[model samples]
Target: MSPVLPPALRGLPVAPVISHPVGQQTTVQPTTACELPQQSATGWLKEDSIASGVLIVLVLTGVQRLIGFVRSLLFCRWLEPDQLGQWDVAWGFLMLAAPLTVLSLPGTFGRYLEHYRAAGQLRVFLCRTAVVCLGLALVASGILLVMPEAFSWLIFGSGAQQQLIGPLAGTLLAVIAYNYLISLLTSLRTMRLVAVLETVNSAGFALAGGLLIYCWQRSAASAIVAYGSASLLCVVAATGWMQAIWQQAPQICPAIPQREFWAKLLPFAGWIMLVNLLTNLFMIADRYLVAQFAPGDSEARLALVGQYHSARVLPLLLASLASMLAAMILPHLSRDWEAGSRQQVSRRMNLGLKLLGLSLTAASAVLLLVAPLLFGLAFAGKYQQGLDILPWTLLSGVWFGAAALAQMYLWCAERAAKACLATALGLAVSVVLNLLLLPRMGLQGVVLAAA
Candidate 1:
C-alpha cells in the first residue's frame, strides 16, 4: 500500500529509487532539472578550481618576475662583479639552508592540511608544525652565529667574508618564516593572496635592496639587510591575515591520536625533505664548483659567479614558474587522490605536463631569439661570458622545470622517496659532470654540465 502524501507534497513529483545488489551503494538520480546540482557563477573562485588557481598564479607570478628582472638588472648595474657574485652565493645559501633547516615540514601542508581540516584537526596540526619549524630555524641561526667563519668558507669559498655570515644568518631566519607562511597560504588554497604577497615581496626587495645597494653600502651585506627587512614585513602582514581567517573558522578538537598523526606525517615529510635538499643541491652545485674549483682567486671566482648569475636570471624565472605551478597543482591532485579518483589525477597531471612543456619550449625559443638584444642593450655588454652561455642555461632551466612538474605525480602518490632517489642520481651525475668539464672548459663547461 502506498502511504498518503501531504497536500503540499502531492503537487511535486517524486524521485524514483532503484534497488541494487546487497552491499552495493545506491544513488538516486535526479528527476527534474531543478533537482540537479548547479554551479554558481562564482564557482571559478572556489578553492577546488585548479584552472582558476593556475591562472591566478601565472598572472601574478609573471608580474613578480618582471619586477625581479628589473631589480636584477639594477643590481648588476650598481654593483661590481665581485659584489654581485657575493650576493648570488648568499642568495643561494639562503634558499638551500631555509628548507634544510625546516626539514621541509611545510612541504607536507598541501597534501595533508586539507585532510586534517576535514577531520577538524587543522589547528593542532599547524601548531605542532609551526613549533617544530621555529625551533629548527633558531637552531640553524644559532649555529651560523657561532661558526660564522666555517659557514663563510663553505658558502663563499673563502673565510674572509665572515662579516657577511651574520647578516646571512639573520636573513635566513626571515626567509624561513616567510616561506612557511607562503606554503601555508598556498595549502589553504588562497592562490590570489599568495600571489599578492609574492608580488609585494619582490617589489619590496627591489625598492629596499636597490636603495641599499645604490645609495647606502654598495655591497652584498646591505642587500642582505634589505632582503631580511622586506621578508619580515611580509611575514607580519601574512600572519595578521592568517590569524583573522583562522578565527573565523570553526575550532574543533582533533580526534586523531597524536601518535597516529606523527606516524603518517613524519615519513612523508622526511622524504620531501630529502627531495628538497637534493633538488637545491642539484640546482646550485654548478655555482659551488665554479666558486671552489675554477682555478682562480676568490675575487675572480666571484666575478665568474656574477657572470653566471646574469645568464641564469631569465632561465631561473621559468624554474620559478614551474615551482609555482607544481605547488598550486599538488593540492588539487591530493584531493582527487583522496576521493579515489586516481585515473582523474593522472589525466590532469599529464595534461598539465603537456601544456607546461609546450608553453615552456615556446617561451625558451623566444628568449633565445631576444638573447642578443638583451645582452647588448640591457646588460651593456658587461657580461659577455654569460651571454655566450645563455643557450645552455636556458636549456637546463627548461629541463629542470619540466622535471619539477613531473615530480608532482610522485608527490601526490606519496612516493616522494622515489623522487628523492631520482634527484639524488641526477645530482650525482651533475657533480661528476662538473668535475669532469669545469677544469677544461671554464664557465661554459659548468653551464653545459647543468644543462
Candidate 2:
C-alpha cells in the first residue's frame, strides 16, 4: 500500500522508485545547468571568450620579447663578438637547465588540478604536487652542487670561468623553486599575474644589464649578475602570488590517500619530463654542434654560437604566438576534455592551426625581407649573412611551434606517453639529420636538420 502524503507533498509528482542491478532501490536526479565560476583571463584578450587569456599572454610575451630584442641589440653593439659569445653560454645555461628545474610538471600539474578539484581533493592535490616537485628539485640541486666547477668549464668553457660555478649553483636551486610555484599559479588560472611576472623579469633584466654594463665598464660578469638578479626577482614575485592564491583557495577535502595520489601523478610527470628534456636538447643541440664544427679557437667557435643564436631569435619570435595560445588554452582544454566537450575541443584546435598558418606565413615573408636589411644596419660586417641562416632557422621555430600545439593537445587528452613518443621520434630524426648534414652543410645543415 502507498504511504499517505502530506498536504504540501500531495501536489508534487512522486519520484518512482527504481530497482538497481544489485537489487537495491535507486532514484534519478533531476538536471540543473552548471554555472562556471568567474576567473581572470589574460588582460588584453579578455573579450576573446575562450581564447582571451592566451591571446593576452601572447601579446605580453611579444612585448617582453621586444624588450629582449632591445637588450640583445644593445649588448651586441656594446661588446665584441667573443664577449657576446661567452655571455651567451652563461645566460643560456640557466634556460638550458629548465627541464631539470621544471620536470614538465606545469603541464601535468594543470591536468591533475582540474581532476582533483572536481573530485573535491583540491588541498590534497596542491600538497602532493608541491611535495613531489620539491623533492625532485632537491635531488637535481644536489646533482648540480657536486662539482660546480666541472659544470662551469663544460658550459662556459675553461677552468678560469669557475667564478660562474657558485652563482649558477644558486640560480639552479632558486629557479627550480620558481618553476614549481609558477606552475601552481598557472594551474590556478592566474595568467595575468604570470604575464606580469614574466614582463618584470624581461624589463628588469634589460634595465639592470644596461646599468651594469655601463657602470662597470662593460664586462661579461656584469651581464651574468644582471640575469641572476632578474631571475631571483621573478622567483620572489611568483612566490608571493602563489601564496596569496593558495591561501584563499577553497579546500573541498582535507585529505587524500598518499599512495593513490602519487600513483596517478608520477607516471604523467615522468613521461612529460622526458618530452620536455629531449625537446630542450633538440633546441640547443645546434648551438653546441655549431660551436664544435665552426673553425677557430674556443672564442671563435663561441662567436659562431652567438651569431647563430642572434640570427635565430627574430624568426623564432614569430612562433611565440603558438606558445602563447598553447599555454592559454591548456587549462581550458583540460577541463573541456574532462567534461566531454569533444566538439568544442575540435573546433578550437582547428581554428588555432589556421590562425598559426596565416599569421606565420605573412610574418615569415616580412622577416625574410626585413631581417637582412635590419641586421646589416644594426650590426655591420658578417651579420648581414645572419638572414641567410635566418630563413631556415625560422622554419624550425614555426615547425616547433606547431608541434608544441599538437603536444599540448596530446597532454590535455591524457596521452602523455604518446606525446613523449612523438617528441622522441622527432628528436631522433633531428639528431640523425644534424649529424649527416652539419659535416657537409656547416651551420646551414644544422638548422636544416632542425627545420
Q: Residue-wise lDDT of candidate 2 within 221-264, one digit each (tens)?
A: 77777877887888876564555545544543445577877777
Model 2 whole-model lDDT (C-alpha atoms): 0.63
Query: Cα lDDT for residue 147, model 1?
Result: 99
Weakest lDDT window of 10 consecutive positions for candidate 2 = 1-10
* TM-score to native of every candidate shown: 0.79, 0.73
Candidate 2 regions off by >4 Å? 1-52, 90-92, 101-107, 114-146, 156-160, 217-220, 238-243, 249-258, 292-294, 325-359, 380-385, 401-418
Q: Please report how far candidate 2 places residue 232 from its true position, in Å.
A: 1.7
Per-candidate RMSD vs. true structure?
12.7, 12.8
Best by lDDT: 1
**Tens digit of per-residue lDDT, candidate 1, span 389-440:** 9888888877876787777677667564576578778888889988999889
Clashing pairs in 1: none
lDDT of 1 at 92: 75
Candidate 2 matches the true fold with a TM-score of 0.73
